[model samples]
Target: MPQNRPRRPKVLCLDDEPAVVEGITRTLRKLYDVTGCTKGTEALAVLEADPGFAVVLSDMRMPEMNGAEFLAKARELAPDATRMLLTGQTDLDAAIAAINEGQIFRFLTKPCPPPTLRGAMAAAVAQHRLVTGERVLLQKTLRGSVEVMMEVLGLVSPTYFGRTTRLRHLAADLATALGHPAVWQIEVAAMLSQLGYVVLAPEIAEKVYYGRILDQRERAEVERAWVQAAEMLAPIPRLEPILWIVRNVRRTAADMAHQPGASPDLVRAARILRVAMDFDELLADGRTSAQLAIDTLRGREGHYDEDVLDALEALRGGGQRSRVAEVPVGALAPGMILVEDLALASGMLLVARGYEVTERLLARISGYPADALATDTVRVVLPREQAEAA
Candidate 1:
């Protein structure tokens, strides 16, 4: 068997002058897979086609789009790619604009020596590696930790975990329906939004979960618990954005309207989560149907984002499309959504309706005594794909 060589990092070089682009490619060809383009528009097209480019280098004075404008668009196209600007020694204004607009990693003056250009390309590649490596590490470590925490929540508080799981799916769906970006962050926020309930007395948590009215002191205590949960998660690396959503899941759109430096996406995500959670709770006690719950939310003026509410209303029809069936506990499978509250014969709620079953959830469910369940047959909506197959 032949040993395979490691793949070189891809570098995209763009300039109005074909000769300059060719020069850049020549300097970095040995260490990188270089693609040279004479126009910024053409380079942008290349970037859109293959976002795997590790670095993008552009000259300051391009015909259609200057270096600053090109790199700024490139940032939106391939955020992980490191961008650099090559400018004339007198193009100091353009260099500053590049830094401010494109978040250029580095800028080199024109007539740059081959050795210096090579080193700059090498450094840009290294920066790309650092960014991507940290992202991978964060996903593996932080996301894995979150998964473990959710599993523990299942073990300790199955009811809340079920709510968390359902909310996560709902948040993702609503985000897509609303055409919101960064849907994963909204999903993660939903998954962890109920962490505060873990510390609450079961009765209080159940009341909150079921949307029962709370007294002043009980409401205050619940607020304290939410803050504590956010504090506990604050120590996790790269989790600030998600934590912000979780902490503000209860905040209305108006509440966040005037807050300084608040991101629109984050605000939208928080609103999405808030609506999903409240809607879930409305149906939790089995007293309200989806339409009635939506109506109730609509009546609460300015309490939620109108756009998010519209998305929720639109997604309501999707549930009716799924094929619902009653299955014995043992026959239950992943991807099925619970259609009714899962309870014990003693009338204790184990899991709420709308939860998507998973293997981990099955493991948790198995811990209950056979005779403890209210019924052997449980109602579930088969996932759309499975329903189609059936």
Candidate 2:
């Protein structure tokens, strides 16, 4: 007999009768790691505790909760899990409810043969794989492309996006603290929030960075470029949804929360990018420290959403501590993170703080034989192992 694979995707089967549950388990046990439950409540408990079950199969007409209701709960718990309904032949309404409300992938009549049950389970598992695999691809591939673009921008337009290294971390932290599902999108948006600088003149960029009032024409140009960036980025694959959040970033917190064009995830991503951008600008002004900048924003009503404000507060719970040590430029390694802004002899910012030193940056530093860059000591944050070694 062919033995069941230990690493096969797990499937949870729920039915009111022990005999039915046992039969279902026996059928699927060879292909999948099957768990049999006599009640829907037990199945739900398993989903909550483990959440690794790729397919949830529930029988209709259970005493505690119907198949549709149980599957609905399952959907809320594990949206990625494929739901399937097993109903009696006469229960047309039950099957329809499962399909419509529970969003079940397939419904089978009671007394399904061993081969039929096997095929249905195979299809459900395939659906689960498709959804979860797509999510992983988006998170990895899209994030990678966005980071590459930001890295190149950081090299060319340091003053604009250099500060964004810190902003990205802050926004990502806040999104994680609030349990935002599309956290990678929010972080990518934060990093690319200053992308409009690609179009702005260096002087105009400085004016915006320092919070100086721009002339009517300059302000209008900046505004147009800000909206133009989304249009430019929309053509990239998997970036359409991210640009959707980026475009709405100009909207106020109230607009983001209530606007018809913005979905809830979009609203969250918009608020995060908005706060991250404003917070970065506030820090760049050098009027106050990071904590004080957040404090100032907190005092300005209608400027930020309260939940975002709370998330920023949580971020501040760890006060700023300069853990980096000064090292000569030659001592800089590829893995180290810059602790302070690096500027050229002409006072043009070269790289923003919190940027990880890369081989490319190392080569740039080597090319600059000037006294300010080649021989000067720069501050950098070291990883725990490197710090200990030092």
Candidate 3:
């Protein structure tokens, strides 16, 4: 006999009958690491010592502890393990309790055929692997795509970009705190909410960023970009679902443009993105930092979500600080640092770390008083030590 075969999955079979344990062990030993336990307590101890068991089949009516109680503890100890209940008793309540409390993956009656047992065990193991693999892949793909999209958007239009990033983070945090699954979709929506902007003209982009009241023609043009963007992405198989979400985002925003009452989740995501984008604009437009948030909130009578407004207010008072700086009127220059922590009217940060000074920025700084440098603001080009030490 070969001393060893290929690594096999470990399984724990719990039953009060010695003959059943012997038969199951003899049947499965060739394919699995089978451990037979007569008592639930003994089974638990075995499981505690070696939690690699992929499938745990326990008798429904054990003496000391029932199958439900044992499987419930098993679920906590080895969360990845697939639990199955075996019973000769036809107690519907016990079966329901086993499923509800123990999270049993399968239920089998006593005198199970060897082939049936083998098939069930195999199926449970396969399902466990498939579900775990898909979850891992989904997380990896979602995270990587979101990161790449954010980077691309930042490169395309550095000025008005990153609003969604902030909003997504805030929304995700809030959703997690509330234990809401809808938050996951909201976060994804926030990440790609501005995908339609890529289809907009630079002039239109500028108007949107500057809070310049858009005329009827401009509003219609901007609204059409959402549908255009969805169409552009429809051919890409991987992006189909994302495009669907984007379409809804546009519809929600457009519906709430002149009117109100849309999906609450969409409304919340849109409002957050709207505020975040406007905040970015105010920073670029040299708006007053001190009262920008208050002003923006006041202006959202019919446009923004009131709940999102509350969240933004909480963000200000809470520790959700932005990395932007506020420079005084005089200390502004190309490559000069912004001393004040300027919160854009839309609640976005202005002077983020590593932000480069441009000619337009230099011009804006020159208009300010030379001696009136905002406390702690400086040019970006200064030595790291000097900037920090100052």
Candidate 4:
């Protein structure tokens, strides 16, 4: 059987005038699927139904919501969609100003020639493909790269490496609660947040993991590690956003509010990472109960954003249940969270509870001579889907 031809990219045109909607739709429908709306609000409804529209063209002047306002909201609704502004002579300046606010991809003056409109739509379609294509690539490749890099870090820095793993899980939970997109970047940043610790003293990693207090000088070293690790990862392709989030993971909420120029995604990822890291520190120390940790986070002014804390609290209220299974070392796989202290015969802590399991970590654990180990069956908290399967 022959495969069906792929559908053409969809375009949305919004204007208060029926004539304008018909004109734009008629001009583009021959080459593309066009959704035309005479009301900006109705267009928003159209967007809500199918956010996959490749291009949004809105007139600069309209009742209630103007082009800029509509496109701004549209940008939030479908960030990957390319936005274009249609402006009259009198509204050109307003449209230009709205460019910054709406993050519009292109603008066309009123009475645009059919040729010019076609070209602009073509360019918008190309831009949409570029943006959405890059996002897909990052989602596929970067996720694997982050996993392997963190797993390799485990070979030399098991304690702090484990903290990064735990933080990733917590960050993911918070992201889901807030309907925040870009969760892949958030999870990757949480894992890489501990990269700085790999260069610090071994004892320092253990201390930080266990929430052991460090003197001023030691604290400075930890801060330095944070900066250094972020710097190292900054040059990698498609990792710039995650690095920014990781570098600012320790910044106060006040600092975040003042950095008006940073990407909202960056701010969001950083805020969640901070709360999760701090919350994990308390858990690792065993000095505070889960409820107490939540309370402490709430009172730490300028530390965790209120919205972030609220999301975390909502997540906590649900009681995150864990599913554990006793499995031999040979059955271990990457990404599992250990529920017990994995130790060698000499009683050295090989790995700690709440640690994210990885292939490299498992390899080392299994490499230990059989005579030096007491038991082969390790208890691990399986991922939800896997637990369900079991």
Which number leads on lDDT? Answer: 1
Q: Who is ahead in lDDT, 1 or 4? A: 1
lDDT of 1 by residue, 1-390 (tens): 457988999999888998888878778888899999998889889998988999998888877989999999999888899999888857667778899999999989889999999888889999999999987787667666787789777767878888887888888899888867577778778888889889999889988988889999899989999999998898887888898888777766777656654788788888888899888888887878889999999998878878878788888865534788899987889999888778889997777776778897788779888899898989999988888888
Among these predictions, the greatest TM-score belongs to 2
Better of 1 and 4 by TM-score: 4
Q: Could you arrange the candidates by lDDT from highest to lowest? A: 1, 4, 2, 3
The digit string of per-residue lDDT tens for model 3 on 1-390 reads: 687856788889999888889999998898888999999889999988877788998999978999999999998677778899989989999999999999988899988998998899899888777766775677568756776766556556654344555446555665554434345555776667666676788789767755688999989988887778667667764554444456654344656444333454455545555554454445544455625764665585765556655655565556444333444434444544332333344444443333344465456445545444333344334434445655
Off by over 4 Å in 3: 1-107, 111-122, 182-185, 238-241, 250-311, 322-390
- What's the lDDT for all of these models? 0.85, 0.81, 0.66, 0.82
TM-score of each: 0.84, 0.88, 0.50, 0.86
Q: Is candidate 2 or candidate 3 better by lDDT?
A: 2
The lDDT of model 2 is 0.81
Candidate 4 residue-wise lDDT, 219-338, digit = tens: 999999887987899789877777778777777656765664567777877888888988888888666778889999888776677998888877776656457788886777876788
Candidate 4: residue pairs that collide: none
* Clash tally, candidates in order: 0, 0, 13, 0
Candidate 4 Cα RMSD after full superposition onto the native fold (Å): 3.1
Q: Which stretches of candidate 4 lie over 4 Å from their true place?
A: 1-5, 48-50, 87-92, 109-116, 139-143, 234-240, 259-264, 286-288, 299-302, 319-322, 358-369
The TM-score measured for candidate 1 stands at 0.84
Q: Which 10-residue window in model 2 sums to the lowest lDDT? A: 314-323
Candidate 4, residue 207: how far the Cα is off, in Å: 1.3
As for TM-score, the candidate ahead, 3 or 4, is 4
